[model samples]
Target: ILILFFVMMAQMVVLTLPRAAACLNRAQQVLEIEPSIVDGERTLDDGAREPQDEADAVAVFDHMSFRFDDADEDTLCDLSFACRRGQTTAIVGSTGSGKSTVAKLLLRFHDATKGSIRLNGVDLRELTQDEIRGRIAYVPQKAWLFSGTVASNLRFGNEGATEGDMLHALEVAQSTFVLDQPQGLDTPVAQGGTNFSGGQRQRLAIARALMKHADLYIFDDSFSALDFKTDAALRHALQGETRDAAVLIIAQRISTILHADQIVVLKDGEVVGLGTHGELMETCEVYRAIAESQMKGGE
Candidate 1:
C-alpha cells in the first residue's frame, strides 16, 4: 500500500503530461478509502451529503495509467477522476496533454495499465465493452458521420431514434438550417461528413450525441471547430435539454468550461488543478496562468 501511494502520488498535476485536452494516468492500484468524515463545519441546517458508498457514484477511476502499444514512457501516469449524473466535468489543457485519452478510457477503447475503472461499481475490464459503452455517447475531436443524411447521422446514435428524435436533436443543435437546404434530411453527406463546414459538422455531432441521451456524454475537443456564437448557443441548449445527464467536455477553450461543475486542469499528463473555476484561480498557480493565458483575463 505504501509503495502504491508513493508511485501514484509522485507526479505533478502540472507539467510532464500529454498536450491533449484530457488524459487518465496509468494507475497500477488505486487507493480505497472507507467512508469517514474527518472534518466538517457545524451548520444550523444539515447540508445534503454525498452517498458514502463508492458504488453510488456514476463512475470512478481508481489509480489508472496508460501508454501506447510501443511507447517506452507512459502517456498517462497515476490518474484518477470521477463523474456523476447531472454534473458537467471539463478537462482542459494544451496539446499532448492526453485530453482525448480520458474519453478513450471511458469508452473502454484502451485498458488501464494498473488501476481499475468502474461504472456503477463494476470493474470496466470485467464489463463487456458493448455493455459499458451502451450508456455513453461519444463525440470525438473529429466529427465522424456516416455516408448519409443529417437524419441518418442523428439516428445512428440510437437505432430506435424516430423522426421526432432527429428533429429534437437538430433543434437543440440549432441546425434548423437543414430545413432551408435543398433536400433536408435526404441531402447526401459525404463520408466522415467532409462536405459540411467545421461548425456545422460539430453541431451535427452534438445533435447525434444528444439523441442518445445516454447516461454519459463525452466530448473531446468537440467544440474547438465552432464559432463563439454557435458554441454559446449549443451550450445553452445542452444545459437545458440534458439537465439530468452527466457531461464530460474536453476542450482547449477556457470559456467553454467556466460554468462546468468541475474543471480539471492537466499539464504534462498530470492533474495540476481540480476544482470549480474560481477555486482553481485562487489556489492553483499553474491553473491560473493557463486560465489567464487562454482566457486573456486577469490572473
Candidate 2:
C-alpha cells in the first residue's frame, strides 16, 4: 500500500509542474503588453539650437596648429589658408582630417596655439567677440528650425527681412512647398523642425541663413541632406549670389565641390592638395581616390 501511494504522488508532481510552468509563461506574456498612454507628460521645452563657432570671422589662418587636451596628438598642424572675398573655397577630407578644426579656428571657437588669424585683414584676436561674429551666417549639416511659422524662422535671422525676401530665400533653397502649403508662410514648424522631412528642414535652415545675406557664408556639410537635383539648384542659386561674398563649403561628395574655384584637400591635419578640380585630378592621389569612390558610389 505504501509503494502504491509513492507512485501516485510522483505522477501528480510531474503533471502539476508542467501546469505551473505554463501558467507563469502566460503571466509573463500578459505583462509584456504595453499599456496605452492616454496623454503625454511634462511640458515641451522649445529652444533654439546652440550656435557653432563665430559668424563675423571671414577668416585667414596663418600657420595655425592645435590639439585638444584629451587628444594624444595635435589635430591640426601648420594649417595655413586664406578665405578671400568673392570665391567659394571647398575643403574635402576623410573623417578626422581636421576639416572641422579649420572651421572652428575661423570662428575663434578654439584659438590656434601658434599662428595668427585675421578677419578681413584685421587680427581676429583683437576684435570684440560680437564684432567678429556679427556679419557671418552659418548653416550646419544638422539643420535646425525653431518652433514658429516658416516666415518667422527666416525672419529670426534678420528681423528686418521682408516676406518677399523670405520667398526669395525659399526659392533659392530649392523649395516651393513652403509656398504650396495651405498656410504658406503662416505654416507652423515644430521645434527642431521634427514635423518636417529632412530635405524640408535643410531648405528651411538654408532659407534662414540666406535671409541674413551675410558677408561670409560658412556651410559645413549643409548640402549633404539634399537630393542631387535640389543640390544642383541650390548650388546654382548660391553661385550667383556669392560673387561678391566669400563662400566656404566643406563637403565629402566630389560632385558637390568639383566646381569650386579652389578646393583644399586635407589628409592628417595638413593640406594634401589645393587647386581647381582639373588641377586636383592631375596632381592629387587622395582627391583622385575620393573622386573615384564618388563615381563608383554614383553620388
Q: Score each candidate by Cα lDDT.
A: 0.79, 0.79
How big is the positional error of residue 42 in model 1, measured in Å on the Cα after superposition?
A: 42
Give one clash count per candidate, in the order shown: 31, 2
* Candidate 1, position 22, lDDT: 33
- Compose the digit string of candidate 2's lDDT tens values, residues 1-299: 99999999999999999999999999999999864312222111223121244232356777878877688887888777767667889999999898877777666676666777766655656555565556677887799999988988999888998888888888888878988889999999899999899989988888888888666788888888788988998999988766777899999888889789889999998888989999998899999889988887432
Clashing pairs in 2: 56-132, 56-133
Every model's TM-score: 0.79, 0.78
RMSD of each predicted structure: 17.0, 13.0
Query: For residues 43-92, could you state the per-residue lDDT of candidate 1 as single tens digits?
Result: 21234233467533567777788877788987877778888777899998
Best by lDDT: 2
lDDT measured at residue 252 in model 1 versus the true structure, 0 to 100: 88
The TM-score leader among the candidates is 1
- Candidate 1 C-alpha error for residue 65, in Å: 1.8
